[model samples]
Target: MITRLGLIKTSLIDYPGKVAAVLFTAGCNFYCPYCHNPELVSGPVPEDFLSMEDILRFLEKRRPVLGGVVITGGEPLLHPDIGVLTGAIRDLGLEIKIDTNGSFPAKLEQLRPDFVAMDIKTSFSNYSRVLPSGTAAEQIVRKIRESLKILIGNGIPHQLRTTIVPGIVAEEDFDMIIPEVRGADSYLLSGYRNQRTLDSSWAEVDPYPAEVLEGIAEKLRLAGVPAQIRTN
Candidate 1:
C-alpha cells in the first residue's frame, strides 16, 4: 500500500509531449527547498493509502483517452513496491514514466520504467544540511550516478534535469554535474518557482530568468551535453 498525496489525471507539462496522468506519492528522501509538493513533503503519509483498485478503475476508464501514466514522488525509490505499481500499470498496456531523484538504482533496475526523468541536484544543493546527516546522502548520490550510467549506456528513454535555484549555482556547478552526464539524451534546465520551500531561506531567493537559463543550457550544450531550457 503506497501512500499517495495527489493525482493529476492529465498533464502535458509533467511528462512533456505525452498525455499522461501524474500520481504524486508521499514522502521524500531529500528536502529540497524549491519542492512544490509540500503537502507530501511536510507531513506523514495518511493511514488510508490509495488502493490499487481505485487507481486501476480510473486507468481503465481513461484507457482509451490517455496515453500513459507518470509516477512521480518526493522519491519513488523509497517505496519498495514501485515496481509492483508500475508493473501493474504496464499490464494495462500503457507506457510508464517515472520521475525520481535517482537514489535507488537497484530498485529502479527492478521497476524498468519505459521512460524516466531524473533530477540532478546542483552543487549548491545543500548536501550536508538538507539531507539526513552523513550516511544517507553519500549513498543516494552513488546510486544515482551508477543508475545514470546504466540508463545512458543502455539507451533508456530518459531525460536529466537540474532546477536552477537563483544565486545558489554559478558556472562551476556544471563542471561537477556535466562530466557525469555529458552526452545524455536530454537535459532540462527548469527555472525554480518562487514559492513554498522546505527551508525558509529559499522563499527569499529569486529564481533565474528564462534567458539566463538558456545561457546556462547553451553552455552545457556546447560542452557536448544535449539539453533544453524549459521555464514556466
Candidate 2:
C-alpha cells in the first residue's frame, strides 16, 4: 500500500549477528530535532526513491549476503501499510526488525517483527513541538503507551531507547521513562550526534557531555534497566 521511499543496503547496528538491509519509509508523526534522517522526516523524499517491488527484489538478491531487513522510519509505523511490508519481508524467511516511535500498537501486532526498537521521547519533548496540540499529542502518546505495553506483555524481542539531547533531555527524565520500560531487554542511551540532523539548531547545539551521559547510564543501571550508552 505504501510503496514510496529510500533504502540503505546495510547496517551493522540495526540487526545483530546479521548483515541487514535498512528500509527508510517516508514521513513521520513526530518532529524530534535530532532526527538523523531529515530527508525521510519532513523533507520530501527523492522522486527516484525505490519502489517496494524493487526493494524486495534487492533483498532477494542479497539474501545470502544479508541476514535480515531492518524496517525503519520516519516512524515506520506511521505508514499505513507497514504490516504489508513486514509481511512480505517475513515471507522471505529473513528476519524483520522494526524501528518505530512506538506510536502504533495495532500495527506492531500486525507486523510482529522479530525485533523492535522503540524510541522513548523525553517529557521535555512536550506535545506542542513534535506533536500537534490538538488531537495529535494525546492520540500519539496513547498509541505509544499501548505499543510499549504490548511489546512488554507479549515477550517480544525489543529495546527501549532515548536519544540524549543535552539541553532538551535531563538526567531526571529517566526516572519517569525507566519504570515504564523496566522489563525491556535493552535500554539504549543514544547520544545525539550533530553530524547530520533535521534542524540546523541540532548541528549548532553541543551534545551532552559523556560524563553526563555516563551518569544517566549509571542511573539507568540503578533503575534496573540493562542500559548501554552509545555516543556518536
Candidate 3:
C-alpha cells in the first residue's frame, strides 16, 4: 500500500512554475529533529486519509487547472507502491515531482519522476547526528551520495534542498557540501521555521538570520553551484 497520509488540493509554490497538488506519504527512515511533519513520519496514520481512488478522481476533476502533482513524505520512496501511484498520476497528463530524502536512488531511477526535490539535511559528516539512532551512517551517506550522482549523471531535473537550521547546520557546514554538489543545477537554501518540530526542544530554537542564509547561498554560488534562498 502507498499509505498516503495527507493531501493539499492545490499549491502555487510546491512545484516550481506549475500549479500543483501535494500528496504526503506516511513514514520516513530519518529522524531529523528539525522535521516539521512529525505526524506523517512517526505518528499514527490519520483515518481520514484520501484513498488512491479519491485522489485520482479529484485529480481528474482538476485536470484542466492543475499543472502537476508533488508526492512528498515522510519519504515517499519508503512506500512499496510508489511506482504504481506515480504511474496513475502520470496517466493524468501531469508532470510529477517527488520530494525525498535521497535514500532510494534505484527507485528514483526506476520511477523517473519529472522532477525530484531531495533534501541534503546536513553535511555528510553529520549524517549520524541527523539520522535515526543505530542507523548505518556510512551506508546511508553512500546511498545519498549515489542518489545525487544518479540525478546529475542522468540529467534529471532536480533541486537539492538544505534547511538552514540554527544548531544543526552552521556556516562552515556549507563548505563541506560545496564539493558534493559542485555541478548541480539548482540548490535551494530553505529557511528553517520552528513550528511543531519532531523534537520539541527544536520548537524553541530560532532560525538563522536572512543575511546568514544569503551568505551560505553566496558560498555555493562562488563554488559554481547556482543557489537561491527560499524564505517560504
Q: List runs of model 2 lying over 4 Å from the truth.
A: 124-129, 132-135
Query: What are the Cα lDDT values of the candidates?
Result: 0.77, 0.80, 0.89
What 10-residue stretch in candidate 2 is worst by lDDT?
124-133
- Pitting candidate 2 against candidate 3, the one with the higher TM-score is 3
**Model 2, global lDDT:** 0.80
lDDT of 3 at 135: 97
Best by lDDT: 3
- Candidates ranked by lDDT, best first? 3, 2, 1
What would the per-residue lDDT of candidate 1 be over residues 123-189, giving only the tens digit for each residue? 5244544465454666667888888987897777899988888655655678777788876889998
Cα distance off (Å), candidate 3, residue 199 = 0.8
TM per candidate: 0.90, 0.92, 0.97
RMSD to the hidden true structure, all candidates? 2.3, 1.9, 1.0
lDDT of 3 by residue, 8-83 (tens): 9999999999999999888899998989888887767777788888999999999899999999988999888898
Best by TM-score: 3
How does residue 180 of candidate 2 score in lDDT? 77
